[model samples]
Target: MNYFVFGGSGFIGTHLINLLSKKYPNSVVYNLDIKENKQNGKAIYINCDVRKSIELDVPITSNDIVINLAAVHTTPGHPDHEYFETNILGAENVTAFAERHNVKKLLFTSSIAPYGASEEMKTEITLPMPNTPYGISKLVAEKIHMIWQIKKNTERQLTIVRPGVVFGKGENGNFTRLYWGIKKHRFFYPGRKDTIKASIYVKELVNFMLYRIEMDKTDVEIYNCTYEPAFTIEEISNAMMKATGMKRTIYKIPGGALKFAAGVIGALGGKSFGIHPDRVKKLMISTNISGKKLKDSGYKFQYSFDEALKDWYKDNDNLYLK
Candidate 1:
């Protein structure tokens, strides 16, 4: 069977493509994206922009697997319209393309943003109360794919993975920024240390997705993809310190003072400092998620939080971002 990955040039898609190539050596793998898959040259590239009707000239069959990873996910990074334009439209287009090809299996990478900001653990069954444009768009996109799944219920298989803060090599987001801050000793805890940031390593996140897809029993699968008992800020920071051997003390900065300092620095530095009041606010907010569903399914994660950080450290020459 052939494998098709939309937005496969991205961080998670790159890893998934690399893994697919190794695991299914004889099968054809197609990477369709607005940008080319420069890292995985083996994936047959297709210039695809899912915001509009997707037109593919590839030789795909009903037996092929289609994975949609295209979306504008970064919060405060894009205009509100950009999220809907890319996420909602991309979902519509991708599902429509899958329908046209009669593709049976499709996977979509969603986010825990649908749960909004929560200190309580959110599961797959949690009622989505998306607050941000990104979260709302993703929730809508999930329903869009779900509609596709139920339409061809007997034949179609859809798995939606809602991951929280996925980080590893090639990731340029939260964890990477944290890594740099820690390395340079600029990292400081803001007010509290108990802020839970639910997360899963990229390798483990993809591993869980593949595991769900490979199950013999065919069923509509949707689950929150995160480690159980999600790490607190202090826990995450200590793990990073242990991984990189950067054992300097992390000072706890007062919340109000830090916010004022960040605003001042950002005003002067003008985006170079990477310290914004909004960013500080985001850091303090907990994104607690539950993995009980996956765990209940007898799927074993390959990495613990500490081990995941350690593996990431090894992969990036001891500093995961570099």
Candidate 2:
């Protein structure tokens, strides 16, 4: 088997590559990213950008599985246009390319951002009303994939997965922010600490993606890829503090102050959250996505949130604030 993954160098993509390579030992897997290839594999890296309808130089045939994972991931500094271009337009290009090449299957890595925030829990049944350009772009990407598959009568199967916040070893993105802040003993609890948020470890999510591609019978399905257990910010913080033996100087601040400060600091650095703004927002909002569909489809996750934080601390004991 041959597999092609776009945006392969990113954390989730890398995890996918590692998992696929192990599962299909005889298969060839290629990782495509805009950056120059600095990877090795049964698994090779192809430096390609998905922003345009450019033909992949890799020899794609009917048997190959194309996983579109590329995007301008959510960051405070990323311009809205950049998000739309890279997330929506880039998805367009990937779908177009998939159709052109007659790939056997196209799996898109979308996000829970498509569902937006809620005071209540979000499930696959919830209507997607994305709040940010990032979320809008992801929702658009899902629509594009659906439209292309429907209009073309393409034989290629499509699977869309909207994963909650994912974290694991070699973690980047939002998880890294939390990890670094806790490691430095500089993090604080904000708003109500009981705000429930869902997550999946990188390995668990990628494994499920592969499972759906290989075994699931549903056609053109979308699954909320997350863990069975949801956790509150305070619970997660306590877990990290226990695992790392770090002091939790987490002062609960008003949610209004956090929002106001995030705006101010976001403008200044365009990136750094002055007070870990991202974490503050996450702790106030209930963004816990359900994984019932995946479970119903006969899949189980190996890593719990506690296990994830413990492993992170174990691996980086030297980096702890102490």
Clashes of each: 0, 1
Model 1: per-residue Cα lDDT over 6-97, one tens digit each: 88999999999998998889989888899996898779988889998988776878988899999898776899999999999999999999
Tell me the deviation in Å of residue 253 in model 2.
Answer: 2.5
How much does candidate 2 score in TM-score?
0.89
Model 1: lDDT of residue 263: 90
Per-candidate TM-scores read 0.97, 0.89
Q: Summarize candidate 2's per-residue lDDT along 1-322 as a digit string, tens digits.
A: 6988888888788778888888888988988888743443556876788986667666778778889989887656687899998988888888787778766688999999888878777778899988988899899989999876676454557889988878776666656677666765545556678877787777788888888888634358899887766777777777777766677577777887877776677668745443545646666788878888887887766767777667666656635421
Q: Report the C-alpha displacement of residue 68, candidate 1, in angstroms.
A: 0.7
Q: Assess candidate 2 and give its lDDT.
A: 0.76
Superpose all Cα atoms of candidate 1 onto the true structure and report the RMSD in Å to 1 decimal.
1.3
The C-alpha stretches of model 2 lying farther than 4 A from their native spots are 37-42, 151-154, 216-218, 247-249, 258-279, 314-322
Residue 171 alpha-carbon offset, candidate 1, angstroms? 0.7
Task: Quantify how close model 2 is to the true structure by its C-alpha RMSD in Å.
Answer: 2.9
